[model samples]
Target: MTNALTITDVRKTYKNGTEALKGVSFGVRGGEMLALLGANGAGKTTLIGILCGLVTKTGGSAEVFGVDIDAHPEQTRSMIGVVPQEFNFNIFERVGDIVIDAAGYYGIPRSVAAPRTETILKRLGLWDKRDAVGRTLSGGMKRRLLIARALVHEPKLLLLDEPSAGVDVELRRGMWEFVVDLNAHGTTIILTTHYLEEAERLCKRVVILKRGVVVQEGEIAELVRASGAKNLEDFYLRV
Candidate 1:
């Protein structure tokens, strides 16, 4: 399969002289669900930010489906959708409009964006609350709304950043199932989550970061066998 994303010797440094990503490199295969594992301050967020064009890379390269992100930023954005770790939408906006308008950013006409918006909203179980304001949704619904917004444009690559954070157990599991279904239907997914078991269960491959660099990476089973660790969590702590 072709690569959905490729990162080669990618580097990032902040204005304060801190290196947040130090020559990190990895490839996510087409139709692959990859887990980006890291502790806090491990450059996970920075990496995602770079992929989404929210942060600029200081060196090296990143590409989406063979298209260089820096060279063709608009094309990159058109191919990828991101569900950020935080709720960044306007609280006062109508729920449906928040999602529908997101498609406008991609130049999707309102006629096409509206139906797609409704479809994603209903699939995420937020159809009944379409008229409600963003602030009125519960934690789970709010998380679902982020997903709906990401999916409305039918992006081929989806970057989910701590999507289940603050979500209830049942709701989180439901999301897992939904995401699996999404991948099965052809969307490549790169997931960043603090939940080790969730990563083990959902992703085929993983890249673990420590202090802004790739410390370990491989198939889930291979990493476990090589480290002689009982599970991902045990292996994570050791690294």
Candidate 2:
């Protein structure tokens, strides 16, 4: 299978001498679900920000599919959709309008975005609330709405950053079911979360980061076996 994402010796440094990522590198295969596991300030967010064009890389290279980020930034960025950790939509905007507007940013025409918006909202169980404003929805619904907006453009790669944070168990389960189905249908996903068990259950492979660099990476089960740890959480802490 072709790589959905490739990073080679990527580096990032902020002003005041803070290095967010130190030559980090990894590849995620197409149609695979990957868990980017790390503690707070471990460079997980910085790595993701660079991929989504929200942060600039100080050195090295990256590619989405076969397109180089530095050479074809617009093309590479258009191939990715990101669901950020925080809710960023306008509270007063209607649900349907929010998603349709997201598609518009990718140059999708309104005629096409309308029906696509409807389809995505329906799939995410937000169709009935389409006319409602963003602040009117429950916390779980808001999270789902964020997902709807990300998928409106039908990107090849989906970056989910702490998607299940603050979500209840039942809602989180449903959300994961949707994500699992999406991956099964060929959307390559990279998920970053504090939930170790969730990562172990949902992702095929795992990359563990510490102090802004990768310390271990491999198939989930294989890594656990090699580490002689009883479970994923144990292995994570031990590493």
Candidate 3:
């Protein structure tokens, strides 16, 4: 099967002499959930930005389901959804309106966006709070709102960046279930997270990055056994 995402010899360098990514590369299979593990300033966000067209790479290439990100940015972006670490919605806007408005960016009509918004909000457990403003919701609810907004257009590949950050354990587990269901339904997912347990639970494959370079990439179980580590945390430390 063709990969859902492909990055080859990708590099990014800021004008201030910071190299965010240095010849990084990876591939994610369709319908697969892959964990991108890294510390702060490990270039994970830069990589995601390149794929989303939010940041440009100085060298190399990226493709989404076979479409080149640089040559066909609009087309590739249409195939991906992103839930960033921060909440970017208008705090004063109604929950339902935020999602519907986001769908409009993809040229999805209100008539189409309305019901799709309803379905997504319901699935993410945000339907009851649909009339509330973003500021009124709890932290976890706000996170769910981000996921709802990202899924409004139902893209083929989903990029989740530190989604469980600041969320309580129970709420995070609930969010994981929803995300697992999404992957089960064939929505390819690439998750960047600091939670090692979350990564082991949800991802079949793992990629560990250190200082903009890939240090390890393999099936989670195999990597753990190969390193003779009890879990991902130990394996990560060993590497």
Q: Model 3 Cα displacement at 73 (Å)?
A: 0.8
Candidate 1 runs further than 4 Å off? none
Q: Local distance difference test, per candidate?
A: 0.94, 0.94, 0.95
Clashing pairs in 1: none
Task: For model 3, give the 10-residue run with minimal summed lDDT.
Answer: 48-57
lDDT of 2 by residue, 1-239 (tens): 66999999999999878998999999999999999999999999899899999999999899999789989989988999999989999999999999999999999999999999999888888999999999999999999999999999999999999999999999899899999999999999999999899999999799999988999999999999998999789999998
Ranking by lDDT: 3, 2, 1
TM-score of candidate 3 against the unseen true structure = 0.98
Model 3: per-residue lDDT, tens digit, 1-239?
Answer: 88999999999999898999999999999999999999999999999988998898999999999999988988998899999988999999999999999999999999999999999999989999999999999999999999999999999999999999999999999999999999999999999999999899899999999999999999999999988999999999898
TM-score against truth, every candidate = 0.98, 0.98, 0.98
Considering every candidate listed, which one attains the maximal lDDT?
A: 3
- How many angstroms is residue 157 displaced in model 1 relative to the true structure, after the best TM-score fit? 0.8
- Candidate 2 segments exceeding 4 Å error: none
- The predictions' CA RMSDs to the true structure, in order, are 0.8, 0.9, 0.8
